[model samples]
Structure formats: C-alpha cells, structure tokens
Target: MTQWPISDAVEEMPPGLWIRRGAPPPMFSMHRHDDVEINLVLEGQLHYLFGGEPLTIRAGEIAVFWAAQPHGLIDSRTGDMCWVHVPFSMVLSWGLPEAQTAPLLSAQPLITHAPELAARIAHTAERWGEEVGGSDPGGTADAADGPADEDGAEIALLEIQAALRRILRASSRARPEAPADGGGSVPAARLRQVSDMAQFARDHHRSALTIADVAAAVHLTPSHAMTVFRRTAGVTLGEYVTMCRVAEAQRLLLTTSMRVTEIAEAAGFGSLSSFYQHVSAACGMTPREYRRQAR
Candidate 1:
C-alpha cells in the first residue's frame, strides 16, 4: 500500500463543490468536512474506515455520504476513482425531497452499483474538475476556484442532485415523497451567507475561533449571525465549532500516534481537561479508550 504524502492544502480544509479523479491514495488520515461526498469507483475496489465502521466499494459503484462524519481511505486495491464534494449547507438549501436527503444525512453511505450511470457521472465529474481547476490526481490544485461562473456552478449542482435522486430511486430502502413546502425553499442571499459562515467555521476551527469571528467573516453582526445560523443550520454556531474540534480530535486519536495532550492542542482544544470532556461527551468514551478500541 502506498501512502500519499499529505499536502499542506489537504491539512487545512475542504473546498466548496469540488471534483477530482485519480488513482486511489491507499492511505489517508481520518478527516471530516461539512459536505455531501460522492465517490465513484472506476476500477478495482476501495476500502474505507468511516467513524470506526468498515465500508467497501467496488468498480461501477457510486457511494454518497455526509462527509461531516469522520471517514478515510484506510486501504484499497489499485483503482481509478472520481470524488465530488458538495457543501452540505448548499445541499440543505436545495430542499431536496426528504427521501433523497434522509439517506445522505444518515451515518451510513448510500452505495449503488450502476455501471450504466458510471460513464455519465465520470464525464460530468471530469468536466467539473476541469472547471474548478482540480483535475490533478494528487489533489494539489486549489479547488476554491469552484465553477468558472455562477451559471456553471448551478448546472453542476443540478446534475449532481439528479444523479443522487436517480441512485435513490433505485434503492430498495427509499420511498417516494414530495418535498415539504417550508423545507422546500430558502432565499438565495440567506443560503449564500449561511454557507459562507459555515465554510468559514470549518476552515478556521483549528484555531481560536469564536462566534464573532464566524460572523465577521460573513460581514454580519454576531447576534444576527448566531440567529440566522441556528435557524438555517439547526445548530448553534458554538456547537458547530465544537463539533468540528471533536471530529478533528477523533481523527487524530485513531489515525495518528499522537499523545492525548498533543492531539488536544492539534484539534484546537483549550486544555487537556476540556478535550477529555468534549471527546467523552461526543464519543461516550475517553480518548485512551477510544484509541484502545481502534487498536
């Protein structure tokens, strides 16, 4: 197995709606981001460790998961793959019918084998990678370029949603349901602001981040930012930032041989005690216990 060198870019944060295609990077540290990720295996098989659970996807299979949960490519057989990351906030704003959104929001990935759709998704994803300037297999190019234009971005989003809906349509566990009226729409401005704020938090959580900092990034007052973020995202700004920290700690605990104190600092915890408290509350186990179980 080959472990690809971790780039500084990869260590920082995930970019908005991005696509990349390349040979499988056999080793990856556990990491999470606020996105709905779609992975298409073009050849061979790929194995993953997601939140301590094992998952495998073979050629011609498409797997979609909420990337907010910790996941990584722990191992794999040689293969080419395409990866797509859609900002979760943007996905939420789309008001996708409950049936489509439910499966993505859950911890388990929605995996489907459809060789027919494989070619189409690959072509589309490749085109997206080109537009975003992220076609490099090593993932060195910056994906923050996003779409060349707003129109292009919207088209990409529509196509991705359609692909997901089609996959959901083929699933035995899904049911037909209309999108809820109130849940079906959000103002474009509100969506953009909330997405920006959420993305800012994800990008800066490994620092001394605060609600005010998040609000400032979006040019909104702290009070208004908190209100809108809570209403739109269904989570408090503070809670969201803490969630990011806890996730980072979990990843480091299981994937790296770092001491608990070192991991706490790396994950942006203010103190060792605070790290222990949050990790226990989030995982129902101490850091040492969690690491021991993984071992």
Candidate 2:
C-alpha cells in the first residue's frame, strides 16, 4: 500500500507537522499516514472513503480524520479543497489538552466534532484561504500575501485541534448514554446489509454513488437502507460515506507528491473542477496552492 501524502507545505514544529497548502485532488489512490489529520472544509464538497463508507464533507463542516488508519477520496464535487489539515504525530508531541484530541480519535467514523468550535476554525481558515489564494495575498491589510501570520495561523491550528478534542470526548460520553437498545438486536439480515454497504464504500467510492447503490447492497429500498444507516451510525448514509472519501483524498494529498489532477482521478473525482472544489472546501486551500505552500 502507498504511504500517505505529505504536504510539501509542512512547517516543522518539533516532532509535529503543520501542513498547509495541499496537493490538488486526484493526488493519491490509497495511502496511510504516520500522523493523524484534522480537516475543516472551507469551500465545496469533499468526498472521503474510510472504514468502508463514503462521507461527503461540505463547506461549513468540521471533521476529524485519523491517519493511523488508511484513507483517501475517490472523487469530489467541489472545485478546490480549502481547509486546515493537521497530523496526529504533532498532537501527541505537542502535549496539548487531551480534551482537545480525544473526541476526534473516538471510535465513531465521524461526528459533529464540536460544531460551533469547528465553525470558528472554518472562519479563520476561510480568511486565510481567500488571502492565500489571492493574486496578491500581501496587498491586503491582514498581510495577505506574506504567508499566514505566525500568531493567527498557529491559533487557527490550535483551535482546530482543541475542537476535535471536544467532539471526541462528547461523542464517547454519548455511547454510554445510548439507550440499551440503541444498537438493539439488529436482525442478521439487516446487519449483513449494513456490512455490505460499508464494504461497498471501501471498495468503490471512486465509482458513481447514489442512495440506491448503498441501499441495494443490502437488498432494501434506498429510504429504508438510509434509515438503517443513520440509526446504526449517528450520521446519514450519504454523510458517512462522503466522510470516508474525503478522508481518503486528504491523506493522499498529504503523503504523496502527485499532481492535483492525478490525485483527483485516483481519489475517484468525476472531474477536475469538482475535485478542486471539494478538496479546497475540505482542506481550505486549492491543491496547487496547498502543494506550493506545503513546500
């Protein structure tokens, strides 16, 4: 298996990596990482494949993706991936609050991950994205072109990490809180279907997807299957699977030096424009800009 893509734009902060500017979409097909990554999409839709599911990450989304596991995106509808990507190796070395890291690394595939906090991080990244992607980032009052300010950029990263911690913790508590029957005794037939849907995403996020596709995997109606997906997992089926795809795409971009177009295709992006849009929206920077800045 290919190793995760490493952003050329990483700022060495001891053992941790502060990766900015990611390679364009279609960056990597399948890969793994040495560090965990967190992404706050600031632009369009980001599709991720993880743990046998396809998760769609859209603008105004805060998601925690782990590199400890293999992941990548096969496709994206958004033009560019605009967001913040952080590696877990940095989190462990930084010695920041676990309240900051636990929630994100939790067992669940995905969660709110601190919705409000994520929103705040999104705002900061969006500001940086607009400036960084600008023709003249330096012309602005905020010092747009000269690379993100030392204070502002680091703060944004901290906030993103902290929020993930919050989300992870909150979700963990919820598992205990779940009604004894929440998981209930899922019929073996339904259980098998859910398993199959999960497998389908793991095997086929690059192909075209629809609710029907997942539902059919279990021999159920799309609506019924979606209901099952949401009940078992807190997120909707579409949301769950999209998250997986986006996770996959992000890892590929960070671990390899592949061109955005190549990454986008391998990641399963239907089109370059869509790949850029989703990757930008998810990572908070265009693929080219991500690679350039990562350097």
Candidate 3:
C-alpha cells in the first residue's frame, strides 16, 4: 500500500470552481470545502473516507457529494479520475428540485453506476480538462483534441450540470423509496408536494416566508407539510429555507461588490447577526473573508 501523505487534520478547501483529470492522490487528512463535488472513476477504483463512512467508487461509477462535509482519498488502485467542483452557491442557482438538492446537502456520497454514460462522460471530462488547464498528472487527455477555447469553460459548466441531473435520475431509479402513502405505487403524488415546498422556499427565500406560506403553496397543512418534507428530504423545511438564503448570500459575496449589510438584506437574512452566524457556520468564514479567498 502507498504510504499515507501528510497530516490527517481537516483543511478548508479554497474557494472557486474547477475541473481536473488526474491520478488520485494520497490523502491522510480529511478536508472540506463548500462546493458540490463530482468524481468520475475511469479506470480501477477509488476509495474514500467520506463523512465518517468508508466508500469505494469503482470504475464507471460517478460519485457526487457536498464538499462541505469532510472527505479524503484514502486509497486507490492506479486509475485516472475526473473531478468537478461547482461552487455551492452556483448549484443553488441551478434551482434543482428538492429531491436532487437534498442528497447533495445531506453529507452523504451519492454513487451511481451508469456504464452506458461512461464513455460520453469521460469525453466531456477530457474536454473540460483541456479547456480549464486542469492539472493532469495522469496524462489522460486526447492529443487530437488539443486545447479548448475560453468559451469552452462556460459550455463545460452546463454539461457538468446536465451530467449531475442524469446521475441523480439513475440514483433514484436504483433505490426506490417507499411512498409516503401506505403501500401506494405512485410515490410521485406525495413526493411532488415535497418538491413544490422546496421550490417555494427557493423562489421566495428573500422574503419573510413562514411554514404556513410554503405549505399553502403546495396545498398541504403546515404540520403535514413539515412532516412529509423532513421524511423525504432528510432535512427540515426551515433548514432548507435557511440553506437557500445562505446560498444566495454566498453568490452575492462572490460576484458582487455589495457591502455585508446590503448583502445580508439582499440575500433575505432578517438581521446582520443572523447572516454572520449562518455564513460562518456554512463557509467557516465571514462574508469578506470568503470573497477574499476566492480572489
């Protein structure tokens, strides 16, 4: 076995979005960052200690997770892998349904096996690796494709998002959840309500939204709505709402010149103190510090 590298302390992942194709590195420490991380194992297998659980991602499998949770590469058979890190705030901008967003934030790795999509996914990753100057210690890029243009970066982002959606679909199909309704074949009927409640939260997070308002949007009583959402999403409705607001604040801090006070209001935080507390908890830094790190 390869010797473990360096310390095992959790380190903060630097801010930004990036794509890379390379050999898996030896990691002895668990580290975290606030981004949505996707990994495609092209050859051999990659092992990880993710969120205090041992996970093995074999070839042709793609794993997705919230990087905010401490994770590290523990072992690997000689293999090539592609990695994509999308800022958490940017993922919220995608406004994906709760069914999809919930798992990413759940601090658990979502692994899906889709051999049918492997070749295409690998091709896209190679393209991105070339375009973004991804550190390619593995030398996996196709020589014929050459380097990609600046515009390729934007296109890569869209393709990555699409790939995530596809992976989520495969995951859901693989593990069919029990319906909220007893023994009902159509889980969508109740599941749709959960999705709607999440959408409502995202759409109106900037406003003073109550459980009553979100429940009303989906036509469910507040109590029932909360129950159903927690069961399905593995998170409380209020937690999701706070997630939405924090995501918006992250986006503003990264992309705009707004002051902390203005950003707090713009992102729908009821108070500056509340905003500071949440941002620190989520990003492990103040709004100003997060922006500076990104630079």
> On TM-score, who's better, 1 or 2?
1
Query: Model 2, 80-122: lDDT tens per residue?
Result: 3433444544454454332333333332344443445555654
lDDT per prediction?
0.70, 0.53, 0.71
Q: Which tens-of-lDDT digit does each residue in 140-174 have in candidate 3?
A: 43333433676876787788789887887778787
Off by over 4 Å in 1: 1-36, 41-45, 48-62, 65-72, 78-82, 85-134, 139-158, 165-183
How high is the lDDT of residue 33 in model 2?
49
TM-score of each: 0.62, 0.41, 0.57
lDDT of 1 at 112: 78
Cα deviation in Å at residue 199, candidate 1?
2.5
**Distance (Å) between predicted and true CA of 205, model 2?**
0.7
> Residue 148's C-alpha lDDT in candidate 1?
81
Best by TM-score: 1
Ranked by lDDT, top first? 3, 1, 2
Winner by TM-score between candidate 3 and candidate 2: 3
Residue lDDT tens for model 1, 35-100: 888888888788776644447889988888877666667677777788887777777767665445
Q: Using alpha carbons, what is the TM-score of model 1?
A: 0.62
Where does candidate 3 have its weakest 10-residue lDDT segment? 178-187
